[model samples]
Target: MNKQMTRAFATGLLAAAIALLIYLYFSPTQDLSVEKMKQKLEKDDYVVVNATTYHQQVNELARLQKEISAMNKVKPTIKQKETKKQTTSKQKTNSYHLVISSGTTSAEIGQKLEEAGIIHSREQFDEYLKDHHYATKIQIGEYDIQQSFTFEEIAKVITKQK
Candidate 1:
């Protein structure tokens, strides 16, 4: 009877010790100080409290800057096209037809268009045609182009001819 009591007491003490150890291991009372934070940063090479949020913000700012630059860049082209439209309106009221030959260079076509008052500037027309890859495809023939026709219409008219 005495041995049984001793064994029961030993088992209870062992169980209590195990429970105490487990509670201590899983407890959230761990110390975290500035020195510990610095040590963590050094160990991890770098540290950010909200890395993903910071990265996303930086990307958004870069995209906005790019969009602003693009908008600013397009303003000049819009103004130029508007001015050309005004000038062409005056010329269309008193323009004549000019004949163009096949295999004509883009520069020649541009010059003829300008001379016939179809466009405001030969250089501008040439640049436009070149940029659009239409310089080499202009059909050679007599065209009745006038400033009244939009550039788009003129391109279609020139390309539609065999």
Candidate 2:
């Protein structure tokens, strides 16, 4: 009777051990192995980095930010110049009115100006007017030119009616 009882106790113990092993094998409590995790990350096209390396990269970024902030405090001054170029151009483009008789070619106008002693030479005046493209723009009428007018000024005057 003692031998049979001993045998039954051993059988029960063996059955419990087998059940525990099977439960452990089918359990979801096991974490993925490090090598398996790495393979998975690689297959998913992800980069795996250690914690210390990631912290060092963050520290380097902070250092660069501090250096940039320090550099922004110093400002530079530059001098700007005011030029008379636009004013001169505006003066040249100004219009005026002139008094003249009919049938006035650019050469005739130059001759009139020379004869009146307004300009020195008819040839120079004609060339000046021609170079400035004032010939076609000339008008025949009484004119009021501004003091010290250029050929460009006269051309503007001649082209405009009022």
Candidate 2 lDDT, 16-109, residue by residue in tens = 9999999999988858999999999989999888999999999999999988877654322111112355446545654344466677788886
Instruction: Give the count of colliding residue pairs in each prediction.
Output: 2, 7
Q: How accurate is candidate 2 locally (lDDT)?
A: 0.69
TM-scores of all predicted structures:
0.40, 0.33
**Which pairs clash inside model 1?**
101-140, 102-140
Candidate 2 at residue 149, lDDT?
A: 57
Query: Across residues 1-162, which tens digit of lDDT does each residue of candidate 1 receive?
Result: 699999999999999999999999998996789789878887988854567899999999999999999998999899999998877767657565766776677677778777776777888777877787777777766667767776666766776632
Query: Worst lDDT window (10 residues) for model 1?
Result: 153-162
Q: Of the candidates shown, which would achieve the greatest lDDT relative to the real structure? A: 1
